[model samples]
Target: MQLTTFFFVCITNASSTQFWPGFKILLVTVVVLLAVKNYKFLVLVSHALFLMIP
Candidate 1:
């Protein structure tokens, strides 16, 4: 919920060309924080998601 709100705020505040780089940085920061807090769960979820793809 908070992440979604933050993403929308970032989107609205930035131009198109700036959005991707900012989003990538935001995404990496989030993933690192999540990984630190739940390393095993994060890995398992990612693997499950990978397998679900065709």
Candidate 2:
């Protein structure tokens, strides 16, 4: 699940012309949250990634 979130953020960042750095921060945040079993954070990031993607 964490890996999925990381990939989602990475892809979203790669696709965008700007706001990619924010994705990096989001990726890191997701990783930390995954370590702590914060599934809510994962869900939030996933939705954010979905919104960012085309």
Candidate 3:
């Protein structure tokens, strides 16, 4: 529920500030933080994906 609400808020805010530099930075930071938090899991999944590409 909370995640859905957060996405809704981001969508509404993005519609209005789609070109805002700060928004872009904030989005990048969020993505970076998520990547950092899931670094190991991401690496494992990506490794599996690569192995399947044969």
Better candidate number, 2 or 3, judged by TM-score: 3
Model 1 TM-score is: 0.39
Alpha-carbon deviation at 31 in model 1, angstroms? 0.7
Sort the predicted structures by TM-score, highest score first: 1, 3, 2
Q: Which candidate leads in TM-score?
A: 1
What value does the lDDT take at residue 34 in candidate 1? 63
Can you list the residue pairs that collide in candidate 2? Answer: none
What is the C-alpha lDDT profile of model 2 across 13-50, one tens digit per residue?
Answer: 55575655876676657555664676676576567656
Candidate 1 vs candidate 3, TM-score winner: 1
Q: After superposition, how far is residue 24 of candidate 2 from its true place, in Å?
A: 3.7
| Clash pairs (backbone) in predicted model 1 | none
Report how far off residue 44 is in candidate 3 (Å): 12
Candidate 1 yields a Cα-based lDDT of 0.51
lDDT of 3 by residue, 3-53 (tens): 434534553455455457787557545644554666653454344334434
C-alpha positional error of residue 29 in candidate 2 after TM-score superposition, expressed in Å: 7.2
Q: Each candidate's lDDT (Cα)?
A: 0.51, 0.62, 0.50
